[model samples]
Target: MAQLRYQSRRFWGGLVGVALVLGGSGCQPQQTSTETSPSPTASPQPGQTDPEPPVANPELAVYWVAYKDQEQLVLEPTKLPLDNLENATSEEQLVVAFKRLLEGPANTDKTNAIPEKTQLNSLKLQEDGIRIDLSREFTTGGGTKSMQARLGQVVYTASSLNPKEAIWISIDGEPLEVLSGDGLIVSQPMTRKEFDDNFSL
Candidate 1:
């Protein structure tokens, strides 16, 4: 009887040892993963540059005819076209100004003394003064007052760059000695001061 009891107790102790070993292994904490996911990256953008500057417009004054208080006719100053002529020479600017004079004035209050049919033949810069040639239509019409107004317009516009400079007038390649049916004698190489002194607008 003592041998059987010792054998039974030994068998149960062996089973309990196996159960404790399995339970201890299953109760252990699980290890966390060490690997990580990649982070997102931003896209690159293009660089910016500065803007360009604005271009300038060239300007000059041209003469027109107007009356002061309706008393008498007088020479009026008008602005020329603002063209893109930054690199143009003085001669080129003068020619452009003269052409604008022939086109007449924008204001209705002012009068254009030059005939509408009159045209610019040629213009040249000389050592003595500026030479201007006009079409025959310049002297074809107008009374004494008209003739004087047209002549004043030409003289002032020609010498606009240099008021002291003289101006030689020609009509159809011929020197203008007498102007219109009024037979107004025009002296050659005219100047602004000379015109203002002798000619009445």
Candidate 2:
């Protein structure tokens, strides 16, 4: 009976010790872990444009073309204008570019006759080709080696900037003969070898 009484006393002592530890003033509540918020995404840097290039220029972008008959610069009717042409800064750039082409060299020598004053009435960029209607001046005389090259130079210059398949040359509403003694058309790209093989001078 005395042994049983001692065992009971030890069990009660352990329970009291556990209770005291749990109720201690120094003990604190468990803390919860929180995930930190990710930093905000960054914006694209300048000059790093999207892989797909924009066909028509941006809202504020400027573009220029040549038109001699008209005193001032003008945009090609075929080109899309997000806004009014008058407001575009390219209006001035067109004048400067056209003037430069007029003075530029086509070759030299007996072929050195200056190109006639021609106006670009219309330029249609089609899936298969580009249709260009010129002024009456584009016709007339002036058929020589250098004069023809000058014609090619002008057509090549415009097509290069916009990047199109063929450039069909026309006058009034008809497809005009290329006037070159050799049958070379400006509706598409022309290589130096092709010019040599076809043209005499």
Candidate 3:
């Protein structure tokens, strides 16, 4: 009976040892996987934006008409910092210069041609010349002397772009044949030479 009891205890002890070994082997990490985690890519910093390419500003000349001795109207060259002049087309450059003329004068010695209320209705570059259309207010007031000065202003300002071409002036959309303040009959296309011959100081 003593031997049988000792034999049973030994058999139970061996079974318990085998079960523990099998459980431990099942829990061990596998060596068949050879895959590795991928590395992370670079990202922009928080709240930061990409830098923009550099741009350049170009210099352009805008013509302004003003009285020299309070008697004669003279053409004054105003330098403009045209930011997009380099990349602009020929017509676009002319438009920019014309727009600058409409900005009024920065020089206290210089004066503008069109009335303060006058608006630039349209601007077009034609094969013949540059046609400029202004609001009807452009012909509202001013004496003959003022009208001539204003006319000279438009001629000279536009001439800076073409230098040797003519400029056709229009009021609202119709050709301007008669000027205000004076009943001067203006030709269809006014040339810089005409302004130089009659109005230059």
Candidate 4:
């Protein structure tokens, strides 16, 4: 009997020791993972929009001839659209203004003094004044009045940026001294004020 009791106590103590070992291990803190998944990027809403485009400002003007009456004609200025000059330089703007002037007026009552076939050869902006070179057609087919009117047109249009500055006119590659068979003499490096003071259209 004594032997049986000893064996029973040993069994119970062994069982309790095993149970304590398991319970102690379970009581320790658990190891957690440190890595985490990245969150998804947010998408734009359906009604959302981007920025708007830039708006153009009208600043340039081109000169055209307008008939006041059967007996009278005048020089008139028309504003050119700025949308055509997207990111253009000062020289480029001047070139475009000249081209627009050469294209003639849109109104039926208004007219362009520049000849239809005349072409722009080159234009140079200098420190003292501006230089404009045109095709030989510029000097062709015009009476005294026509020559005066065309000269006024060119002077006004070239000086649109600075009326005080002088302009040197050239035909083909040479300087224009005599205009046409009508014998209209043109002084080189002319200014708008000078043209206004000396000639009439």
Q: lDDT: which candidate is best?
A: 4
- Cα-based lDDT for every prediction: 0.82, 0.48, 0.76, 0.84
- List all candidate RMSDs to the true structure: 21.1, 13.4, 19.0, 17.7
Q: What local lDDT score does residue 38 receive in model 4, on the 0 to 100 scale?
A: 45
lDDT of 4 by residue, 75-152 (tens): 888877768676887678889999888888889878887899999998888887989999998988868888889898
What TM value does model 2 have? 0.38
> TM-scores, in order shown?
0.68, 0.38, 0.64, 0.68
Per-residue lDDT tens digits of candidate 3, residues 57-123? Answer: 3335676677677876777878656575767776677677777777888878887866788878888
Model 3: lDDT to the true structure:
0.76
Worst 10 residues of 1 by lDDT: 37-46
Which of candidates 1 and 3 reaches a greater TM-score? 1
Please identify which of the two predictions, 2 or 4, would achieve the higher lDDT against the true structure: 4
RMSD of 3: 19.0
Clash pairs, candidate 2, are 166-187, 167-187
How many clashes does the backbone of model 4 have?
0
TM-score: model 4 vs. ground truth = 0.68
**Superposed Cα deviation of residue 6, candidate 1 (Å):** 99
lDDT of 2 by residue, 109-194 (tens): 11212244766666655555556666676655555644455554445434543433355666788776556555545433343344
